[model samples]
Target: MSIIVQNISKSYNKAKAVEAITFEVKEGELFGLIGPDGAGKTTIFRILTTLLLANEGSAIVAGFDVIKDYKAIRDSVGYMPGKFSLYQDLSVEENLTFFATIFGTTIEENYDLIKDIYIQIEPFKTRRAGVLSGGMKQKLALCCALIHKPKVLFLDEPTTGVDPVSRKEFWEMLKRLQQKGITILVSTPYMDEAALCDRIALLQKGSILKIDSPENIIKNYDKVIYDVRTQNMHQLILDLKNYPSQYSVYAFGEYIHYIDKSAGFNPKDLAAYLEKNKHSEIEINISRPTIEDVFMDL
Candidate 1:
């Protein structure tokens, strides 16, 4: 495994950020730390990258201890924090050069590694980091992080706030990097992106609810789920929740995803009830389980 975390925990004052959770990522695997904000994903990345000390437990990254081998860990890993920390005042080319210098290397040395990502932003190499678009800044940050040619890359919510097109482009870049055999550990709140990972740890409230391949996780969702649509979504949710036979009901995308407490669930019965309640254009049907559904079930 490229990253191994065992019973690691971290806390601030009295609030525990991470609680004795354990998981591993095989080398060269595109692993995702799946969770929303305050779910302890960032804390785990910090410990593995040797930025923060864990209050308890231990971790290893790239064959080095996080504590005893802190320096080596720092040297072998590229960490792109949730927030952009690159020098904003500097131009794109200058920023990359500076980071390379700090790592005792130059852009020419790793040009082949970052060429694909850099080419998209090369025309704006002279532009200051602050003036670039959200996507451009993302690419530059990735370039700097890879300038050192580290074996492992840690990206914390790299797609948040990015435009849909840019987010798609950025993920494509990650796939290319993975092909080059660099291990990636990424964290994100976007459930749709979870399907792209080889394996994921579903973190919530500082604990892991499950860890498995995206397919396995969704396949293991045993609920009798349905996609429901009606004239008024808001009122329908309230009405469904109040219904004596409803188990779980929440709006998902353009459809309301629901489950029934009644074992002998019948979609026709639900449609009839809604129709009787004056809900026109009602649409209710069974749907496949998605990563989001699995996460909610967890």
Candidate 2:
């Protein structure tokens, strides 16, 4: 394993941020920590990267203990924090040079590793970091993180606020980096991006709800799901939640996804109930499970 975490836990002022979480990343694998804000993903990443000490358990990166061999672990890992923390006053090239210097290396020495990504933003090398666009800033951050040729790259919500096109481009860059045998551990709230990972751990409230490949997770969803749409969306959600025979009901995009409490509940019966309640233009259809559905189920 390039990255191994065993029963790691962390807390803040009596509030548990990470609750004995455990997982591993194989060599060259693009493993993802998928969850929403406050799901403990960032805390776990910090523990593994040696930025913060775990209140309990152990984490190893590149065969170095995160606590005992903090320096070695730090030397081997590249961490891009959730927030953009690069020196805003420095130029793109200067930022890269600064990180390289910290790692006792030069940009020219590791240029080959980040050349593909760096070239995209190379024209703006002289531009101040704070003046760059969100997407460009992301690229420059990535380039600095890679300049030292670290064995593992830890990206915390690397695509949070970028444009959709830039987000797509970033993931493409990740794929290319993975091809070069760099193990990537990234966290993101986007369920769609979960499918892009080799394997994902779905987290919620400082606990992991599920861990598996996206295909397997979807395949294992045993609930009967229905996508319901009606003109009265707000009322429909409330009504569905209050419906005696409903097991689970929540809004998903343009529809309210729901599951029945019993196997024999019929869709026509639901429509009839809605009609009697004066809900017009109701449409409910059986639908396939998505990552968001799995999260909602948890």
TM-scores for all candidates: the values are 0.98, 0.98
Lowest lDDT block of 10, candidate 1: 235-244
**Residue 133, model 1, lDDT:** 92
| Residue pairs with backbone overlap in model 1 | none
How much is 258 displaced in model 1, in angstroms? Answer: 0.6
lDDT of 2 by residue, 1-298 (tens): 9988899989998999999898989999999999999999999988888889989999889999999999998888899998999999999999999999998999999888888889999999999999999999999999988988989999999999999999999999999999999999999999999999999999999999999999999999999999998889999998999888999998888999999988799999999999988899989899999988998888
Q: Lowest summed lDDT over 10 consecutive residues: which window, candidate 2?
A: 45-54
lDDT of 1 at 28: 95
Deviating ranges (above 4 Å) for candidate 1: none
* Model 2, residue 151: C-alpha shift (Å): 0.7
Can you give the lDDT of residue 259 in candidate 1?
92
